[model samples]
Target: LRIIKTVPCLSRADLADSFVLQASKEKKCPDTDYLSENGICCDQCPKGYKLIEQCHAPGQRSNCTPCPTDQYMENRNFYPNCRSCKRCKRNEIPVTPCQPTQNTICQCVKDYYKFDIDGDTYECRKCKQCGVDEKEKQSCTPESNTVCECKEKYYRFKNKCEPCERQGSSFFKSTMGNSLPVCLTLFLWESKVSIFYTVIRRHATGQWSKQTVNYCTHFYLSLSAPHSHLSIPPAALSDLLYTVLDLVPIQKVKQLVRSLGVTDTEIAQAEMDNRYCREAHYQMLRVWAERKSLAGVGGQGELFDCSLMQELLDKLRKMDLGLAVQELETKYGTL
Candidate 1:
């Protein structure tokens, strides 16, 4: 009988060590070269060129061609084709033009910033402009938007800046107890109405002083002079009508105008007179307002009144258009 030799089986640890040794012993291509399909180390194509054919022998250069226009090859590589260059989108300006060896770099134009990303590119949006009573705290940049703050003597209200109102010296004395009476006059114009407040206060020492306080137009009308007839000017009335139109859909606006006594022919004529839908809607509302004024107690030339606004509000409520009604109430305050 022939004698048989037994071989030892490798443990898990021994197999792992064997794999590590094998990996360490394997040859790796240098940074300037890449391993070919034939297991040969071939020289790489330089930047701006793409590989057309592999090297025939080790240490030999590969066949390469320059990248076509609007294409790029950014690094020494073994790729068969060059990459396509990037293009700038709307509201964007090219920072660095695309070249054979590099991709295009883009940035937002002046008064715009990067708002979002679209795949591998950026989408730009217009910057915000501060209101008249506000000042810019930070200027807008390509990467960031504008920052605004209320100016001196103004306070922020509902995202807008409004001038601060002055109270009489007596009112301040009641609150602060050590103030002297001062005279001032404040005039404000709103809806073609010029309003000014004059207050006279008698001091404890028998001195007479006059004081004036400027209050917000809407606030004063709503609270202090509730019974006063504050007629809405024609321009202000037009703005409110447009606001109503904007709160509802176009179909709803047509329904509203019709309900307010605008004829189909009138709507068609308004459409012909205006190029835009919003302008046409405004025209229809204007006609409705004119008709209502003509039928009111005040004569044909009377353009605006509190009754007209209340009537419009009543019609909107009857239509169950709560959003439009709410917007008008919020803007005009109990009109």
Candidate 2:
């Protein structure tokens, strides 16, 4: 095998030409400078044009050039460069600006929604809220999906529920079938107003002894249902009253029970059998007396002094009992 060194001291152009000529001769063809002759081999695309399509050769049209930013070519042509892209439609924001190498993009305005089943997305979504004069008819999350009932009291307007005031000839009231509404209303009234404790109904005339009995009963029932219906015989009421006014210490009750050595569960069951529900008015009175006497520095105010008050009222709309009773006393009780 023989190795040959290239001839030294030849000019760069002359050496290139000699190599081309030799290659042409060896291949039995004429030498042609394809890159320089055809005008395809430039260092970069000129200003206003981008190199989106790659070059095939120095002079060929297949090589180089596309439209600059914010432009596009609708159709292909003999020339290598492209035209600008179109602008987005009204109420639509562009997803991306037009570029020489890519397509234009856009979207719709917020507060205006357009559904698309095929998933070809092109717009923004809208917001949802209740209309004027219409209490929430229905609502939806992410948009419009709720169903609302009206507050119309007397008239049975299409979809609205009947209010208490609409239940009777003179006033709306809760009936058996509409438990939720009745419950909700009862909860609200009891929370906001007071009731009279001494009122006894004149069953004959639908009147009262010292105060309106229906209102008092309603108030009591709302605050303490199931138990409220229990007819507190004179004996029971008298015993409860005596127990409260005496202001006996709770620790004494515990001590008495402990002295008997009876299990706590048994005592609790006995209280339940008496319909005490762990919150007999007597128990609440004991707590109230204790708190009032001690005057703890950082206690939740008077009404909540009795733990049962909070425990029982939390589930209802209103959490006030003493105030409700007081208000009723002020409004209807003779004194």
Candidate 3:
């Protein structure tokens, strides 16, 4: 027979080795509360607020206060204070006006550029000078990128300007005459123009050439492939030569659209959908307003007066439109 005896705790030392050890389990804070280091469960402060007082014990609330202007709390926090808001430099402008949830986005002011494309880099870089083969397609502004396109007769060769040479002919031998089919030259022009900003060579030529071509001549160019050129209808030719230029600063473009009856301005409407381009449009608008000494209370609608918007609309419209078929045929040639 075996006799088993159980011992009872009578002193502090005995309690340490007691058969039935008891400990209060740690409590988990609910989603609405923060589990503090002191083991107190304190309710979370709302957004834009910071906790100033902690709960005395579990199942209690904390004291919070609204963050002051130029300061913000993005999330519910037990922090003693809100974070300081971001500010734009004197030379920089706010592209996105600051909000409680997001910081003010700064863009370099007019005639300036941000050298880096990296989003995290905050400094606006100096606007670079135009390349040798490049012309100012659009001037640099604080918010708009400097756009450059090759000058006439110069072609973009690996982004550098190289003189265009007519095929099967020398510089002197090559004439915009009958030797190079005017239609063929036009085909090359339409085929090589890239995304409204011309910078490509004929897929067939394998070399870059920039010479004035009869882009409107009643000729068709097959665009089904990257470099295939075939005779196309006059309408197709016009469509091929014209594109909704993506490089243009959109805000000034928008001014024209508003004056032209918004829907008739198809190109402008399409551009508004692009986030980067759309913001650039607004940025340029502010610069324009300042230049013209225009009064603007707030919002995009007040950017410019309706009566003064016609001239800009006409200029932008011409860039988006190519020569009509009848005009090309009457003056130029037919395929």
Candidate 4:
């Protein structure tokens, strides 16, 4: 508690030297040596060097050597040998390579994979694709590979699970309208150059009986040449008529003339097809008809009218095929 001469600011180097001298006087290990695990002062090996020999006495230095080019010792230790450097696997890639004082770290290659949720990792498995009748459910990750599942239309076909074709041969539509291929032809139709209705061996790609012709509602003009298929392209009507009619939309239709631009040969061919379709539809209705009439069964009557004449010239004076088809089909029912 008595006030005496005090020195407050001491240089760092002199302060450290005084502290080391006092610590040594107290029997601590000197700067040249460190306390080993066995409680003896020994010369320690530096990182990247391993001890080749140990000292039995406190003042003797341990024999040390640098780790070999292909080996390492990452920390100071009394061990007598360096560890062998890690080698990359065939499917593994080095992230950080081995150095004098560092260990090599590696990971699975891009095309390699493993599914370890938690625990030690095993060898990488190669990436695989979903096979036939299967679809990818989950994409691959660095840790986990892809997952697959059977497709919605998977069915046993020709001894293997295969994708079902849309309403083709062997496929049938269920009551709920789910179509599956059955590998058998349920129905078919054959025509000339233009294929009519063909449910071939694969998918359900075919034609229908009545070829739809969309007449413009405003200009009262034919939008496109009539043909039979499932999808009707609606924009062609809007695009074509808008160019001519002051951009006004199409209106109600006129009583039919020959479809615009359809050739005479096509018209004759169309007449034959229509005659066949009318009779086919008529026979179906006759089954439930209280007053059945097989009037136009064999193309014997007029095509343009109900006149009983094989001479087609009478209707040539004024023929409207679309109106005539409507009148013929409604002879029995309203459809």
Clashes of each: 0, 29, 7, 11
lDDT (C-alpha) at residue 127 in model 1: 85
TM accuracy, model 4? 0.32
Question: Candidate 4's residue-wise lDDT over 1-335, tens digit each?
Answer: 99899788889998887775665556556565666543457877888998877776667788899998989988887677899888876688888999878889877788666533222435666765767876776665445555454465443222233443432443333232454222222212111010112222333466333221111111111212342211113242223223212211112111111222224454455456556643322222222111111232333211111121111112311331223222222221111
TM-score of each: 0.44, 0.23, 0.39, 0.32
Model 3, residue 47: distance off in Å is: 2.0
Candidate 3 backbone clash number: 7
Better of 1 and 3 by lDDT: 1
Please write out the lDDT profile of model 3 over residues 1-335, one tens digit for every residue.
Answer: 99999876488766653432332135666788877655667898988888888887766689888887888877777889778878886568888876655567778887776443222444565665787766886776654445565676665433455554533221212234444422233224432321112223355858656444312211223443442423234454233223222323333366444443444344454555546765444434434433332332223221223222223334443433212221232222222
lDDT of 1 by residue, 198-269 (tens): 456788999988754443332222112343434445666667778888776676788888888899999999
**TM accuracy, model 1:** 0.44
Regions of candidate 4 where Cα sits further than 4 Å from its true position = 1-39, 55-63, 115-121, 151-335
lDDT values for all models = 0.68, 0.37, 0.48, 0.43
Ranking by TM-score: 1, 3, 4, 2
lDDT-better candidate, 1 vs 4: 1
Where does candidate 1 stray beyond 4 Å? 1-25, 117-121, 166-335
Clash pairs detected, candidate 3: 109-142, 110-142, 113-125, 114-125, 220-231, 220-232, 251-281
Instruction: Using TM-score, give the best candidate's number.
Output: 1
**Candidate No. with top lDDT:** 1
Question: Per-residue alpha-carbon lDDT of model 2 for 1-335, expressed as tens digits?
Answer: 99989867889898888776665455421132122222333344443454455445534443446565676654333345566575766556666877654567655555443323222333333533433423564333322223233343212223223333433222223445633222222213212322222223355777645332212222121223443321223343344334432332333344333332335665555566557433443443344333432353244222212222222222111211222322222332211
